[model samples]
Target chain A: MPDTAFADPDAGLSPAELAARHGLGFAGTRPTLGGYARQLWAYRHFIVAYSNARVSASFSLTRLGRLWQVLTPLTNAAVYYLIFGVVLATRHSTPNFIAYLCTGLFIFVFTQTVAQAGVASITGNMGLIRALHFPRACLPIAIALIELQNIGASMLVLTGIVLLTGEPLTWEWLLIFPALALQMIFNTGLGMFLARLGSKMTDLKQVIPFVMRTWMYGSGVFYASSLFAEHLPRWAAVIVEANPMLVYIELIRHAMLENVKLSSTLPHLWLLAVVWALVVFVGGYVYFWRGEQEYGRG
Target chain B: MGVAEVAERPAEAGQRIPTVIVDDVHVVYRVQGPGTPGSGSPVAALSRMLTGKRTPGLREVHAIKGVSFTAYRGEAIGLIGSNGSGKSTILRAIAGLLPIEKGGLYTAGQPSLLGVNAALMNDLSGERNVELGCLAMGMSKADAKKNSPSIIEFSGINERGDFASLPMRTYSSGMAARLRFAIAAAKKHDVLLIDEALATGDARFRKRSEARVRELRAEAGTVFLVSHNNQSIIDTCERAIWLESGEIRGDGPTADVIKEYQQYMNRK
Candidate 1:
């Protein structure tokens, strides 16, 4: 044996003293909140590049390539239109139901995709997480960005469809940008929150689709908010109307269609939209960062 | 050298600053039943989901059971062990990739693991992956762009004609490993962990990588190389740590530790 002489030479010193002397501290220690924010900001370029690459690579294998971004949602709208409009005769009850349905489908899918992708962000990038060290939030943020890009592409198709459905190009249509932007912030927050949650409970992956489906139904994606007020209990009606997704979907529909009537029960939709966006964005971000050191662990 | 000569050696010979201090660190992996979802029926899974009770049977795998070591700057340490002996786990723990279940690890700077397989995307072209890898390692876009040519040249993938332009999935395993090693080696790290990065390289490439590791160490960095190839360990490292079943069997000069490890392996 070589005497093992160097073993624990700093045994006599306190941890703080040892840290000061050797320029070391506990490994995997969570950075300070401000430091964490700075580190994340430094990685902004990587997040953007990663999101762009994944968005482009996502469709590379398909023949339609990037066109699928637009086509997938349109196809979904057509399927819902056939079932809800023709089979269920929902269009007879709601005026300009094609435009209304398309707006709802396009907007709802944007949030849905963001949530789903966010849940998978950490679980999907296990290889990268296990191999390299960076802010784990980057994965979820990148997923949200990918959804944002996809929604941006799909919006072009949405604009054309709204025009085809006889909704005039009024200045109110400009409100769509703010509506989408608010939803983006809301979705990004939800994505960050879910990313941390999904990393801990793999079972969340199985439950998300069902949860999103219920959320879609409650958000009045295929129907009007008035249906809830007319049929459901008073408390249930408030829950449906207060849902942030419904607020966004209603906002977009109002922006796109000049004749679409706003329900009397829905109050202060714009203010609620902004408040929900800010609350979720800040809350989810902090919630996700709190678990930063716990991610990628067995 | 005898034990006395080794003992007389200065503890802080080349560089006095301790780059890595792993103080009685332990890492446990909670492997869910059989590493897959249980064979329960979909109805059972659904019922469990509905009840919000997702309790999978848990088993703890103690990958590193209280390993302690201090690595100083300008030192290259070799970690040698049989399969699943926790060599890679230790490197990962030091890199902060694995959470230490007990004790603590302190480091001077972020430890970079030397393997591109985790950082680079297979669907991306090698050229794009190089740029992305550089950016992921904290290099600015301009620096990544400027360094791409040299990274490609160092990896030697382009020698085969347009390999850099091809998607990484098209490359052979060796080609991929070489490219990954090149990308990681392109930037200087304060602490570098090499987990079998040299195992896939050819003889010439391995020699080049060995020289590069030495160059890195000479620049006042600590390096931990986990490799099964004993010769590479002996050649590239001055000290060797022999671990068996998540415990260090021996730690000393490279030749002495390797000799003890080889004997232990032969007896097995």
Candidate 2:
């Protein structure tokens, strides 16, 4: 498919001979994505470095600088709470609904940010990708670093949420951090998938807002997953419980919420998170690599 | 008339021993129709796709077609052609940006297409793009930091002194182009592709840049340059390829190809 790969010159391309010249940080090859994964990890430094530049520069001109990172989300959560907490007064079985909503919303926002940006990642960075010879995966991973910057501020915001709610913590609270990390890995993988899809068909860009909105609501950000316990069928219930985000948010509240129960879904949640991460991480990676030669043509 | 003939030939050749082989790399693209101002419905995209009326937006244009060449270690090749004659396309394809359909392209080193691709950010200071460029070129962070000062000085932008900190966007087009050329030229690669960007800088910078290209060649690097300025190509390149309609009409001594190309132009 030389013609096929090269067919779309103005759009969709891998780096021009990037793997040939720079070696994408691997020697030899394997049948699967082991090569690509290792390459992504090796390119992690590039991701961090570039991400630092983008995040800092993106905010540099403003008066507040990095404070905008914290402020933007803090404001977003405040806006949501004022509407949902005070105006709507949506009560829940889960006490301290403010913290519950904030915790779930913050993590859910991470997934949304990555998804919104991820689809356009490779396509948008066409200029950088074309000129410089490096791993294609670095584009998506680099974007994650932007979210990682948000993590620090968001965590601070979360801790503040906890303080306001007065939720006691146990050792299980420690799991929140790792859960956040796993969620990020999952997000990165999904980002990779989106990068590939977005590069292929820009319609993904159009569909993204609707998709993220659906995901946000279904993720139980407003109330609790427990709200759906009666209406959803057994399989549907199982499916929602299996959502990696649900697991993390539920786990977060269990750890932080005042006297919340640890759902039997913990092992299932951990398994689901790992599997989702690896599946998207590895699956999206393989799909993206199969188009390696295609990236240069675009 | 049959593109299939040329496209099929490469498959018959050796499949996977890469020195720098591009076989029959043909890059064809579709012109997406301009969105018609329709009755305001979001389904306009679907409706457009459903229309089977495919008008060739323009004629089928060939950027690079059936162009074949081989370069060994230590060989410097020049590509000379009329505007839109596919000289830059050839370089981009060799750099793996375009695909060819009618021939084979082989080179030893991964090419850095050093013209349009060589450009740096104008929003940030020249220094930032330099760091980004060096890193993008795959230099380690420490190495990029180490080499950045030398690259800046090598670019002669530092001689402009403190004004260099001003965003490149503020600089004249010439200044921005010169900084880009100097920085891309700063790093040496086994294979380099030079587009016409070198003509932007002052005389002294051009001479220094020429010497750098020569030095890279002396170090056994392969260089492919695309330029309309015949004098520079003849002066710098021992060999040249003349392209017409994305086809290499002539490939041999720089003088032979340039002379033939000139004759074709004069006759027309």
Candidate 3:
């Protein structure tokens, strides 16, 4: 009755209005960037609390409480080392291999979980999603934050492994913070991409595991990037060196492994990390935002 | 009771722009199966290429036809409709969860929608979700932390051992729903949407929550409750909107609208 004209009851909010509201999303309808930013900003607290609840909920039913946090990932590292290190003899130094594999696998596992789970995050939580009016991006961001906690626990275990392996401390480990931060940014985008894809094509869920396993082999989790650094072509070596996780792992390896330099591949590493992180994050976020109105329908 | 008498009321006290405005919201739902729509799949397309026409299985559903209403401050509204009459859909779109096809929905403030079952994360503890629900209701973390204990106490589920420690998955459907209502009611939002979240609770808790909701109304806020129980709406709210097939069939004072609705329902 109060001038109901703005409520078109046809085609919803106009494209320009959407773009203005949620600037980073698909900009045709209801284009209101500042509004979307404010909404996302207001919902940040919800994201944090949701993430915290998820992380803490893991221990609520278990007898050991939060101990399962360390135990779950630590045991996983041990199991993988048994198969890949002792049995397959993954061939870094004898003692170094365990620590190396633990760091690489532990870190990589979390990233993969984020990538895989992210695809279905919005769809998976459609119940709460349909009921609440929070930013759609909050779903993936919450998972990313939760993944951070799981990875943090594993990283702590990796630190212990490195120290026990007789690797000395150095400033090189400081790089891990930035490297890990960049990986998080990169995965944030990857998660967005996967979440949008998952909603549109449900079978992508089945395909993700297959893709992840193939990615793991070439990820240098078990093999040394240094081995290939010497003989590989510059572009190929640089591209491989730039795998965000590998660079991040190298930072971890550098901190843990004494006498390891920052690597001559650092330039190539930084360049590709920056570029891929941007493409995945910005591109994925935009793609996800475009599908905002459709998510609840599923 | 007539239009002139109703119009006699000042718009501010209020009746004009209703504190909560839902203007002709139209929601269209499309059914596209897991596979590609229109073309079916690659095989379907290839077969079509080999034969004549491509198969299509996409269907568009108009969940809500054009609907409009306004509820002024201090007015507690009830939406009555059969299953999927677009009752929940309208509420969600009004709360800004679902996008509207046509129409403007302007809330005086954030409207918290607590459906019958709470629909919360089953893996979290009751208290943990309370904290989350409060935060989701737009309360600051410090405020949510401060309010969690009272919310648990109000729901009358605080005595259980697993109340704070047990996973929500371990709780009964009734218990989880109660926790959601208690938590949502903890905050002082300008507008609240309750989609029959009270049926699971005992009578005493219901009475208590109803009183709190009245208090919410007195504080310059509006509440919309969707329910099939005509008696509850007649007993609690001042206004009722009858929705049939996603359109507003009737909207007026509760007793008056309920009278018309009863006669209409009886006719069918």
Q: lDDT score, residue B43, model 3?
A: 82
Task: List, residue by residue over B1-268, the lDDT tens digit for candidate 1.
Answer: 2322122224453325678877777899876654346636677668866898754555688999877766777778999999999998898888888888888789888998875456578878999889888878888888899999999988889887999988888998988999889888889999999999999988888888899999998778888999988989889888888777888778778888788888889998
**lDDT by residue (tens digit), candidate 2, B1-268:** 1112111112113231223444455545433343345523546545646884433232345676654444544556788777888777667667765444444455554567777555455557778877777777767778778888777776787666664677676777667766777667767787788888778778888888888889987766778888888888988887777777776677666777678888889999
Segments of candidate 1 deviating more than 4 angstroms = A1-4, A7-17, A264-267, B1-15, B35-56, B116-119
lDDT tens readout by residue for model 3, B102-143: 765666556777787456767777777787888776677789
CAPRI quality level assigned to candidate 2 from its DockQ score: incorrect
Q: Say which candidate scores most in DockQ.
A: 1
Error of 2 at A12 (Å): 38
lDDT winner between candidates 2 and 3: 3
Residue B181 deviation, candidate 2, in Å? 3.0
Please give the lDDT score at residue B260 for candidate 1. Answer: 80
Tens digit per residue, CA lDDT, model 2, A176-294: 77778888888888888888889877568989999989878888888867756667888887777777777767766766677554443567667777787777777777777776655
Off by over 4 Å in 2: A1-32, A261-264, B1-23, B30-44, B48-61, B99-104, B117-119, B163-166
How do the residues A1-298 of candidate 1 rate in per-residue lDDT, one tens digit apiece?
Answer: 2133343556566444665687786778999878988998998888888897797677767888888888887898889989999999898888889888888888899899888889888878878898888888888889888988878877888888889988799898888899989999999999999999988887798889999999998888888767887999898777777789999999988888876766433358998899999999999999998998877675
DockQ of prediction 2: 0.22
